[model samples]
Target: MRPKPVKPKGGQESVWDYPRPPKLEEVTKTIEVYFNGVLLVRSARTYRVLETSHPPVYYIPQDDVAMEYLVPSDRTTYCEWKGRGRYFSVQVGDRMEQDAAWYYSDPIGRFGPIKNYLAFYAHKMDKCLVDGEVVTPQPGNFYGGWITKDVVGPFKGVEGSFGW
Candidate 1:
């Protein structure tokens, strides 16, 4: 017989809690993302930009992205804390990068706030902009931190990185 299913402790969430974005605000960051010398993603879709211990990630909505450049990707990643994260690819001029963008469709109620937004790997793109100023991606291959003119970071994915 199957073991009795463990239930979530009262008031405590299971490991399926995707980190929810902060409260929505009237954010007006002029954001841009590029790849293969092409501007693949550009928008002013920054709702709540935050610089966490990880990186400065701008949570953006579906309306903000030019979906013409996006297509469904077959890749998926699961974090014990974030549930399953789905992936997408930015298609532009015949160059395609797989699983470069990700989102959580079914996060625990605690992180239910960000059910529809997405984030991209800033490094995979050739360029990015915030507020009309070109934003430099943080130094790493796997992190999406937008290090612009003012923000700084002790960002992850940069420590002890070797040339890939």
Candidate 2:
């Protein structure tokens, strides 16, 4: 059963209104990510993938990220819309978050714009900020969507939403 979507308030967008195939949009907002007391990345040149029943997944350019802290992991996952994704474990000092980030080196179709851009799991980070507002991580371990005040949802990745 599909859950009812939350009604969007002023200046807000409902995830249900997002596209099925997903849309990749360039974002100019200041996106910042912090992990293990380290500023992982902060950039205005970022992209967000918007899909139905999910909060936007922000992708930061490789140039802006602290690549030294990200070690490639053997794990990989395939997305029907985005193609194959490779994982990265974040290691800062002795603290490591395994499979905490992912990216597509060669994206399929419309997702090519995000090639080599990294998307971090908000739940794995100390905090992720969009336009200065700290975001909440989307529910469940499998999806990495970032929920902010401006986005409303009965988001996917909840316990009963596997079929959404």
Candidate 2 residue 34 C-alpha distance from true site, Å: 0.6
Runs in model 2 deviating more than 4 A are none
Lowest lDDT 10-residue stretch of candidate 2: 1-10
lDDT of 2 by residue, 32-139 (tens): 999989999999999999999999999999999999999999999999999999999999999999999999988999999999899999999999999999999999
What TM-score, over all chains together, does every model reach? 0.68, 0.98
Residue-by-residue lDDT tens digits, candidate 1, 36-146: 777655566555434233436665677777777888898987755446888889888788887777878986545566576777887677667777767666665665666
Alpha-carbon runs more than 4 Å astray in model 1: 1-26, 36-39, 48-52, 161-164
What lDDT, from 0 to 1, does candidate 2 have?
0.95
Q: Candidate 2 has what TM-score?
A: 0.98
